[model samples]
Target chain A: MIQLLRTLGHLTVDGVWQVGFATRFLFAMLRHSGPSFARFSLTIRELYFSGVLSLVIIVVSGAFVGMVLGLQGYDTLQRFGSESALGSIVALSLLRELGPVVAALLFASRAGSAVTAEIGLMKATEQLTAMDMMAVNPIARVVAPRFWGGVLSMPLLAAIFSTVGVIGGWFIGVVVIGVDNGTFWSQMANSVDFREDVVNGVVKSFVFGWAVSLIAVFQGYDCTPTAEGVSRAITKTVVYSSLMVLALDFILTSFMYIGK
Target chain B: MNRAILDLWVGAFVALGFAALMFLAMQVANVSEEGTRGETITLRARFEDIGGLKVKAPVKSAGVVVGRVAAIRFDPQTYQAEVEMKVSAAYPFPKDTIASILTSGLLGEQYVGLAAGADSEMLKDGDRIEMTQSALVLEKLIGQFLFNKAAEGGSK
Candidate 1:
């Protein structure tokens, strides 16, 4: 009994301490991020590494997801004799929930894990120490650029995902399923409000981007400098950022849909 | 690998991202025409029971959408629901038009249907529609039907 209680206490203290340290580290990173913007090419290079490389997966998955939504939505709506509404259903689902969330999850595994691994390796190799000794702030030179790159690319990737998904839904619903083309398009246009649905979705993606990027950089910077430590940090980056994206998505959706 | 080539790829990526956003705003959503709806005239109507009528619900006439419900307010003194709507200026209506709460399908959204009446004057902005019909509540309808049936059996 005593051993169990001690273990519990130790976990509680460690968790609290980690949260506090992460918060302070975030503030330090922001305070030292001026050079990331001043010398913008560093950020651009990271963006290319993270954003451009991840396009194929995001787009292909978007198309497949959309086609599945179309097929499922058609089967369900056909019961009510309202299959023309398939377009609206698919678009709304993609924009409001699936696009930002799934893209962020894929991003966590692909780009986010890569970022953590790279930073963790840099720490393990003493490059960060060399930079520190050379009178250069490692946070500004390395971490901040990658952080900004992930943040900027996330929303754009989500947007592309949703757009491609919508097109894929259209092709399946209209061409393959034989729903009236005009009705499908018109119903979608009528139902989806620019301000309420589209803009809100963009806002969700932006918040997700900010969160996932912060968690990735923070984990990488805080990991121990060793082979096992770098691998562990990469795992934490994917797991923690995925959970953060899902939890934040639920909170945002509740706030957006409360009045309705 | 080179700086110039990397810059070009990054620029292209940014451009593609913006283009996707543009497609979402214009094609997938109704962003472009939201602002270009042209001139509109506001009108008000009073109802005893508005039912599930909501703001932005379509107002139809002759099986076509002519306007949208703009606002709904409840009056404490008279115990009535006052609904405000915006009608397109191109579709002019007479002063004695009838506004009725309607449902599109069996389990679909509620809207307001306008039926024109013979009158010399056309409705202007801020005009009040006098001939209004309340929405048909399902519970009330069932209750009425049961009561009538019981009454008929009692008479027999």
Candidate 2:
């Protein structure tokens, strides 16, 4: 009983400590990321590495999800004799929820994990310490660029994902399913509110981007600098970022749909 | 050399992303055309119940959209919901046109539908459409149906 209580207390203390450490580290990273063109190249490189590389998967998955939504939406709407509304259903689902959530999950597993693994490997190799010893601020040189890159790319990736998904949905619903093209497009255009769906969805993805990137960079920066530690950080980046995106999505969606 | 390549890719990536967003805002959201559209005439109508009617819901005439609901409010004196809408200047209606709030489908958004009348003078900006119909509330209809059935049973 005493041992169990002690373990519980230890876990609580460690959790609190980790939260504090992560916040401080995030602030440091943000402080380093200022309006300076000095490290612009570094930021650009990181953006390319993260954003451009992630595009293929984001686009492919978005299209697939959209096609699936179109098929399922058509099937369901057919039951109500309202197959004309397939476009609106598919678009709303993609714009409001699935597009951002799925893209963020893929990003966490792909670019976020890559970021964590790369930074963890650097730490394990003592490169970060070497840079620190050589009169360099490692956070400014190493972490800030990746942080900004991830943040900037996230919303963009999500937009592309949703756009392609809408197109894919159109193709599937109109071409293969033989739904009235005019009705499908017109219903969606007439119904989906810009402020309520698209803008809010962008805002959600932006917040998710910031959160997932922060988690990735923080995990890497504080890794134990061992092989096991690096691997664990990579796994944690994927799992933690995915959970954070979903949790934040739920909170934001509730605020958007009800709190307003 | 590699930096330029990276910069180009990043710029292109950002551009594509912004383009997608622009499509959503302009085409899908139809946000940009809200109030700034060159020629539009504002109109208002009163209803007994708005019934899920919202701002920006399309105003249609003869199954075609002519405008959108601009604002909605309730009047204390008459206790009716006042809806302000903007119709396209090109599709102006007569002074005696009848406006009705209608739902697109069984479960869909509510919109204002205008039926033209024989009045020669067309409605201009800030016109009040006197002839108006309120929305059909499904719940109220069902409740009345059930009540009538119970009353018939009682009589029998």
Candidate 3:
């Protein structure tokens, strides 16, 4: 019984210590971010790896998700004889919820895990240590660029996902199901407010980007310097960022949509 | 990848992202269309019960939208619901135009409908549409029907 209590206390203390460490690491990354902006090409190179490379998965998945929404929405809306509303239903759902949330989840697994693994491997191989010995700031040169790359990539990726998804929905809802084309487009335009739905969705993605990037870089930087530790850190990056994205999504949605 | 190739790919990616945003704003949300709807003048109407008439609900004339509901207020003294509509300047109605609450379908959204009057004077901004009709309540209609049936049966 005492062993169990000791284990629980140890875990509680470890978790709190890690949280404090992460907060400090975040400030360090911010302080060292000047190189990322001043030497913009370095950030762009990282963007190519994280952003451009992730495009195929984001677009293909977005299309499939949208098509599924269209099929299901049509089946249900037809019962109420309100099939004309399918456009708004699909667009609103994609923009308001699925676009930012699902895209961020995918990003957590795809780029977030990769960022962790890359940084963790560099540490394990003593590359970061060598940079410090050579009087080079590894945090500025290595970590900051990758972090900004992710932050810049997330919103653009989310936008592309939603746009592709809307087209996929259109294909299923309009072309295959025989809903009136004009009605579908007009209904979508009439119902979706640019400021209310679209702008809020962009904001949600931006916040998610900031969170997922920070968590990814922090995990990589704080991991134990060993092979096994690097693998575990990569896993933690995916898991923790996914959870953070979902929790933040709930808070943002409540603030944006509830009450009015 | 080579630096030039990387730059090109990033440029293309950024361009595509912006294009997607443009599609959302123009094609899906109709931002430009709303901007081009022309200047509008406000008109007021009062009803006993507005039903589900929401702000931004379309105000139609001859089955075509000419305006949108701008505000809805309640009067304490007369116990009436006051609605303010912003109608486009292009479409002008006479002073005696009737504004009535209407529903599109049985269970669909409610809107405001205007029936023009053959009067010489045109309605202007901040003018009140005096001839106003309240929304039709389904419960009230059913109750009246039942009452009428009971009255006939008692007479018989």
What are the lDDT figures for the candidates, one per model?
0.91, 0.88, 0.92
Cα lDDT tens digits for candidate 2, A28-129: 887888732375888888888889999999999999999999888988989989898887898899899998899999999889999999999999999999
Candidate 1 C-alpha lDDT tens digits along B1-46:
9999999988988898899888888877866554226889999999
TM-score per model over all chains: 0.90, 0.87, 0.88
Instruction: Name the DockQ score for candidate 2.
Output: 0.68
**Which residue runs of candidate 1 sit more than 4 Å off their true CA positions?**
B34-44, B61-67, B86-97, B114-130, B139-156
lDDT for A136 in candidate 2 is 83
Top-down DockQ ranking: 3, 1, 2
Interface RMSD of 1: 0.9
Q: Report lDDT (Cα) of residue A27, candidate 2.
A: 85
Using lDDT as the measure, the top candidate is: 3
Task: Please report the interface RMSD of model 3 to 1 decimal.
Answer: 0.6
On the 0 to 100 scale, the lDDT of residue A75 in model 3 is 95
lDDT of 2 by residue, B91-153 (tens): 768999999999987988898999999999989889899999999999998999999999999
lDDT of 1 by residue, A1-260 (tens): 99999999999998899889989988888999899899999999999988999899999999999999999999999998999899899989999999999999988888999999999999999999999999999999999999999999998899989988998998899999899999988888878877778888889989998888888988888899999999999999999999999999999999997756
